[model samples]
Target: MKQSEIKNLSLEDLRDKLAESQKQLTDMRMAHAITPLENPLQLRAARKVVARLLTAITEREQESLVENGK
Candidate 1:
C-alpha cells in the first residue's frame, strides 16, 4: 500500500488495515520459519508497510490533539 493511499483513509479504516496487515505479517513470518518462503524479502517489505501505517496513524492522532488543544 502506498503512503498517499493510506493518508486518504480515515482513522478507523487505518486501524482496521493495521490490524489486518499485522496479522498477515505474522503469518508470513511463521510460515517462513517452518520452511523458506519463495520470497523471503516479503517480510521486510511488510514490516516497512506496517511502519508507514503506524506513522500515519500517529501523525493523524497528533493533529487531532493539536486541533483540540489537548
Candidate 2:
C-alpha cells in the first residue's frame, strides 16, 4: 500500500491491518516451505507493507505523546 493510503488509516485500522498482514506473511512462509510459491515476491511485499503500517502507527503515537507532553 502507498504511504498516502497508510497515512489516511486510523490507528485502530493500522493495527488491524498489521495483524492481518503478519498472519498472511506467516501463512505464505509455510506454504512456500511446503511447495514453492508461484511468486516469492509476495512474501517480500507483505513484509514491506507490515513495516510501513507499523511505521505509520508509531509516528502517530509519537505525535500524540508529544502533544500531551508525555
Candidate 3:
C-alpha cells in the first residue's frame, strides 16, 4: 500500500492491516523455506509494508502523547 493510502486509514484499520500483513509475511517465509519462491522480491515488499504500518502507528501514538502533554 502507498503511504497516502496508509495515512488515510484510521488507527484501528491500521492495526488490523498490520496484523494481517505480519501473518502473511510469516506464511511467505515458511513457504519460501519449503521451496524457493518464484519471486523473492515479494518478501522485501511485504517487509517494507510492515515497516510503513509500524511507522504510521508510532507517529500516531507520539502525536497523541504530545497532544495530551505527556
Candidate closest to the true structure, highest lDDT: 3
Give lDDT per model, in order: 0.95, 0.94, 0.98
Candidate 1 local lDDT, 18-69, one digit each (tens): 9999999999999999999999999999999899999999999999999999
Task: For candidate 3, report its TM-score.
Answer: 0.97
lDDT of model 3 at position 5: 100
**Where does the lowest 10-residue lDDT sum fall in candidate 3?**
61-70
lDDT of 1 at 44: 93
Tens digit of per-residue lDDT, candidate 2, span 1-70: 8898998899999999999989999999999999999999999999999999989999999999999995
Worst 10 residues of 2 by lDDT: 1-10
Error of 2 at 14 (Å): 0.4
Specify the poorest-scoring 10-residue window by lDDT in model 1: 1-10
Q: 1-70, model 3: which lDDT tens digit per residue?
A: 9999999999999999999999999999999999989999999999999999999999998999999995
What is the model-wide C-alpha lDDT for candidate 2?
0.94
- Please give each candidate's TM-score: 0.96, 0.94, 0.97
Runs off by more than 4 Å, candidate 3: none
Global fold similarity of model 1 (TM-score) = 0.96
Model 1 misplaced stretches (Cα beyond 4 Å): none
Whichever of 1 and 3 has more lDDT, that candidate is 3
